[model samples]
Target: MRDDAPHTSNVPYLPRRSVHLDFHTSPLITPIAQQFDPQEFADRFARLGVDSVTLFAKCHHGQLYYDTDRAERHPGLGGVDLLRSQIDALRPLGIRTPIYISVLFDEHAATTHPEWVCVDEEGGPVRVDSHGVPGWHVLDMTSGYRSYLAEQVTDVLGHFPDADGFFYDICFDQLSSSATARAAAIEAGFDPDSPAGRLDAAAAVSHDYMGRLRDMVAGDGHDGVPRSVFFNSRPRLRLADELGFSTHDEIEALPTGGWGYAYAPSVARSVIPIQPRAIGMTGRFFGSWGDSASIHPAAALQYESLQMVSLGLGICIGDSLPPAGRSHEAVTARLADTFARVQAVQECATGAQRVAEVAVMRAPITGGEGVIHADAPGAGELAALRLLTSRGIDFDFIGPGDDLAGYRAVIVLSGVGIDDGVVRSLTLHVESGGALVLSGLPDDVASLQPLTGLSSADVDGFAREFVRPNAAATGLPDFDFVLPGAVRRVRAEGDVHTLATVTEPYFDRTPDRFSGHEYTPAGAATAYPAIVARERVATAAFGLFEAYGATGVPEIGDLAAATLEAVFPRPALRIDGAAHLEGTLGRRSGSSIVHLLSYLPSRRSSADIETVVDPVPALDVAVRVRLDDRSPRAVRTLEGVELPFSVEDGYVHFTVSFDDGHCLVVVEEE
Candidate 1:
């Protein structure tokens, strides 16, 4: 294990409110810096409560915004140093301005030196089209473009000596199918076309480039003034050890933009622990980044900002500067409204450590393939997160190799196959009195049988089945028929108790045996166990979470919650609120903060966009926090309103009227 100490930044400050300004300009949009008034821009940012902003030093078109001696300035902007002017204006206002430099897609560099462009196996330049715009050719870092990029970065640093950090964009893996890349791979003893080989080669090249960049930036810092470095992609992977913060441009254009509302939260939750400082970048475009005139609703921005803070992540709202260089007042006002709310909650959330009782373990794929089992872990994990957060379960999304000792329970999502090391760790955790919940058919079930007390013979069927609770299943009703997606039959033995049994349908819905629309009618329950439970471990054969995530089935979540309650027995915090209300718990300096966020979107049915409406009044919501030996001294909202509460059964209970889209409850302990 390598020490991660050097990767941590010594920078003393982190801004909760920040903006990522996009300035990817084209020749058609000339006079790039004409409308950009430094004072007006600084004033707008100050009014919006922005403490940090990333100004573009070089755009994807490979045009320099500043008066760079090494690189050509944009032909549209002859002599205006837009980057220098913005930094000069904002720095005096106590704002940290980072320089944004496009690393991969540099059109000017690719055009000027065609040999430096990334080429495919056919010896042709690789180009990518984005958002109906003709894609620019990406530069190959292994070529002389690497030296040019370094010189450009060094020039920017020299010009802006007081700059805050560097934001490297489009620095992910660029798979080269080019003959040159193939020859290089062959020299390095790897197949150019193999997925693993290509991935490894790309990783090596990226590592070298990022390492050189970090060294150059670090070497430039003097007198305890550290310059932060962050890459756009792979924030949690290869470059995490070298970067200052983990960042993902989660431009979640909900309802339409391909990314549903659940994607950003899942990514935020998973990446927060990987880096000491994690920031989520979301754009304000109505559709996405390129929509210049489109403005995201204020309410939606508010919800997104609050969600990021609650997940222990800094929020960076994305906005593209208009070609005229003038900041949009309407967008600034909308962002101001959201930033004010973010500023209020961040006072308590800042420096707070997340308190999670459950850690969801993401398993590796089977067959030694270094790939995720599904596309983005699928909806099963997302639905599980939705259900758990709605129920006020304090949980964290953890990946492989993350420490599991801190959590009281662990959930292995459906379809994830565990390796031997993970199996051993999980078995040890179970033996040490930790709760374990296994969903779906894990590939390494044979190794987990001792902990689960159930051995799988084979998958019996793949039809629609219902799960009816047995008479012995306490806290769960027998009438609940959960439609678990794919049924896997397991043989219960050695103190393993069957909590529920699978009720098979009349017949499989074949071409000839079809009943009505979807599947055949349900029949009586069978002897096979749908859910099996032991002392510290509970295993389910059905892909219940997958079904629930795909269909939003309440029965599946209900069964899962009940089973978890039975197994874990006591969770850290419990909240009685609407399903749309989500809660996150954290502690800082002897006090606990509970962040309650509302998910009531305005346009729920619109597939084009999601907008947040007025906040729903959640009255008389009871929140119970289990305090082992500490006594509650005071309970109040973030706005300092005292809330009435009581203590019983070693837990503090409080009822709050959450009227806003976000509410924070601070519990002072004695």
Candidate 2:
């Protein structure tokens, strides 16, 4: 589990990544108006740069996506051999094929082997879906579902030896097995009087079931590769690691809203590195009334996915398959284009140059937008975290009076905004080889002046606006490149842009609401930072790119890349994210690539659409493009492009021009 060597595990999510898609036809899928052509669909995937596709299946339909050593056929739909053509067609495209098997629901298995069905205390069978509606039915993880699943997957994999891999969707073992059994036991008086006792017992049972399933599939590497397990929304991804499983999935919101986008940044930050080599990451942007990351370039998708990759996480892009049929031409074309860009990210990034050893663990709270407020970041962000587990970064949501020591960095996201102590802790951390990146209203910077040996006599903090980090000004490198354009200027020393102002919204301002506070941002800080970091380094350190990134030239010149490369050429962990889509970027052993989800632009299309998003987007993001920098250039985004930029004092100010109601600007050091 050390960074010096490869961490051995059963799950592997790299090179040939898998995705989930819908089915056109299935033997037991009842009757429907839409029928998708397997060949056409397979060919379509090949064109879209997809390596694998899956079916949201319940029964082992006779169309035979999986071979049956068991029962027989259902005329017309029997032995269609859909996997064969897909395997054959995908080969030339360099795509590996993988199939997804729904573990919990199988109308066939339920009917054929009724005993396998979990029975309630009332002696009734568990029901997951009643009248075709999605609902939870706690199943028995300790039962025959293990062998049945193994047999089903094994049979499917055996049928198509050419299949690239298998992605297990709806991990029934975790929730169905653990949570249900615990809830049921509590109700049945299995220590129901004690909540802690009930939870402990349930977890023990859940852990046992998952461990068994993992042991059954411990990487013989047959049928392309073993099954890739996605433990849905569970923070304890280590459960998968302990079970010899690798890979995890999460739904994140678009940045501008930032690392706090939907989910807590610390939550994603906490688990990303534990097993990043083949770690799985995913998210839903949600609430994109209409906007793209680029000029109709699936902006949201590109933004979120890229950020994840830079953070050293693999991506499993997710989206709902059309309710009617196979993908529409527009959907397919955009996907192809989006994935191609991801490939480019993989190409441009290499070595440890973009991957930094996560010396700190910082995860702020989620929900409630605006300046510092206690309840803004949720309780989920406050869990205890083990940063040392991930070879790189480690983060946990900060709680009231939480002791933060023994870390080189302490990251605070959009949780409670710029708290005086949080600022002091980061300053102390930086003073001791630590670094910090506080995304969103970073008014706490003013609090650091006292610790950094600076006078904060004229500091006036606001949220919104922007400011840039400086290696020379602050003697910090990690934060050098993350500059804010229109900061609130919370503090001021003569003409210098000190800590910026960020107002805590009335919604985010419930000091006493910490207990009953359903975090709601009701006020606003003067200016909020989209991205912020606290950096430290000696002035003798040359070729420092962070401070020089805004200069549009390598700080140490080309020599930085050649002479004393390790020293001059600083290595970093690039947490890449774009708006629109969700995914991850990670490096294990030296090979680094950006795995991504295809960005879904607004269903409505228009030209030159632009909008202003209050909070800066979260997740790590890097935009690759050629900017016409005759002035401070507003770099182009999937939402749209801007041609002008501004430079004033030590700040770089600019507005993003996009038709989709979003704007972004960077204020890197010059």
Candidate 3:
């Protein structure tokens, strides 16, 4: 199948203002439908500008909210067909309703059928505990639970014929240590204890279960039209090829949650290649999901939602209904303010493609097969991203499977082992006049010697070393001491030139040869070249990006940025603004849109929440867009404020005052 093939028939109907309503109720809760007025709820959503909503059919407690024959309804519910009422109320308003089903963390199913629970390595059921509440055990997909899930999904689809789609929650491959799991593993001809065997077994079971769920939904949709299906797993590198347009939940509880502020932007950028049409899912709570009393500020919610749109992603705001089934009026009001801004940009953002000149290629996790072993960003890659973002450089994260010909330059981070596929693609890119800025040389540098213009020699590394720029290094200052993680000595051949040199310390910092504090001072500059550049390829022997990210050394980041500028002198777009001002470019048909976002959040205390104060004062900014041969007919903001612009040397230059937290500049071509 083609990479851009349509995954579902309902792709055109996917909405920007989608809400994921959480209904995970407990058995002790009563009067579940006391305040559940279907008309009022639907009207509230419509007032909030919501075009799509995901209502819960079944929650994690295995409690069915609706009256079902295949599954038991919640004991706390008062015999109300809540799901049918919701679908009926929302269908007439042109609001698409997608049914949500918790597949793995079904408490009732696990308690009734212990054989279906996944067994961990310690021979115990896989259980989760969340925020002082005892969590439910996970169900093994390879067991009879798979069939039960299929039946539950089929029952829902049969009942709600007008449902827009299905959102499968908590669906993952768990490592099973049960007798049945081991038997299946042995039958697959592998040792049950091995990691590869466990991965293969889990992948196979998950794939089969997902396929079954898809088939059931496809067979029972409205009027022979198959609804769209999405699974909830972010950073799904291993299963991207199998999954379609899904929701990526980057549960970033800003300052204090597990995901930091940078997590969403990084993960969202990386995920675009796998699922281009993916939607970003964040919560309205101050902390995380299921936090009933915690509500985020409207400003915070607006920033998060706009961040998603700026990165070419749709937005889904997550909210949880109380046991009384009453929607919070305060929350709805805040959501209204946030969604209004989303509606303003939805027309330009939808179906638009990101315009990036630099593609920062992530190192292959498992050689070239693209099987994910680790999903976290590497030290060097994270550092490069931070540097680029701080300097107002537009870039995107790409994988081995992504096409590199569209980018003007590609930066390969440290420790990326290039396989045959990557070598072929990079070679073709360079031959087409695209520049390459590689941090470290690949293992098989011999194959790429012609492009790199250097031959590998004896590699010399220090526990801590400094980098000093040579006379040829313009726009870079000579550093007295800067940390470059590792260094490999290379002999320049043909027309290669050394840009910088590595300086070694007096002695290696061992317990016996330790200096006064950290390490000995830098002694003499070595003959080994720190950075080398050929005709098109520039290679840095040291792990400059990774070390700078890990250490946050100002010198390291400055040197790295300088070297990047030297490699790609004239980027497609350049922005001159504050460090916190973020800009991204996107193209929709004959026009280009530049999204400028100013991040000005105040840290009141050491708490995890970021409070948004008044908007910062407008900053003087200049944007230069290289149009090649095309000429711009007009340059203006989305609000129709014309900006003064001039064309010089095949580039369109303009200046704007950025004040309103967010602004979009449209460049229409003639």
Per-residue accuracy of model 3 over 1-670 as CA lDDT, tens digit each? 0112233553334556788989998766776877889889888888877777889999998888887765468876777889888888887786778889998889889988999999999888888767667677989887888788887887876777667778888766667998888887788775789988887787666776777776667532443345667766423456456754343333222322334456567767777766565677777887667776878766667777787888777688988888888788898988888888888886655556777678888766541221122355667767766777655566778876679977888888876668788888989999899988888777666876777877788776777787787644645666655574557777778877777888988878888878768777888888877887777788887676777778887767777777787778787677877756777888777777888777676767776555564455547788887788889999998788999899998878998886667888889888
Quantify all predictions' global Cα lDDT against the true fold: 0.74, 0.38, 0.74
By descending TM-score, how would the candidates be arranged? 3, 1, 2
Collision count for each candidate, in order = 4, 117, 2
Off by over 4 Å in 3: 1-12, 132-134, 219-225, 244-257, 348-351, 366-374, 390-393, 470-474, 600-618
Model 1 lDDT per residue over 163-265, tens place: 6777787877677866556676787787787888987787667777877776666632322446667766553333235443323333222322445577667
TM-score per prediction, in order, is 0.90, 0.52, 0.91
Candidate 1 regions exceeding 4 Å error are 1-9, 121-124, 220-223, 235-257, 365-377, 441-446, 457-459, 470-485, 494-497, 602-608
Best candidate (score: TM-score): 3
Assess candidate 2 and give its lDDT.
0.38
- Cα error, residue 287 of model 3, in Å, equals 1.4
Clashing pairs in 3: 256-608, 380-546
Candidate 3 Cα deviation (angstroms), residue 228: 0.9
Worst 10 residues of 2 by lDDT: 383-392
User: Can you write out model 2's per-residue Cα lDDT over 295-320, one digit (the tens) per residue?
Assistant: 22365555545555455443445433
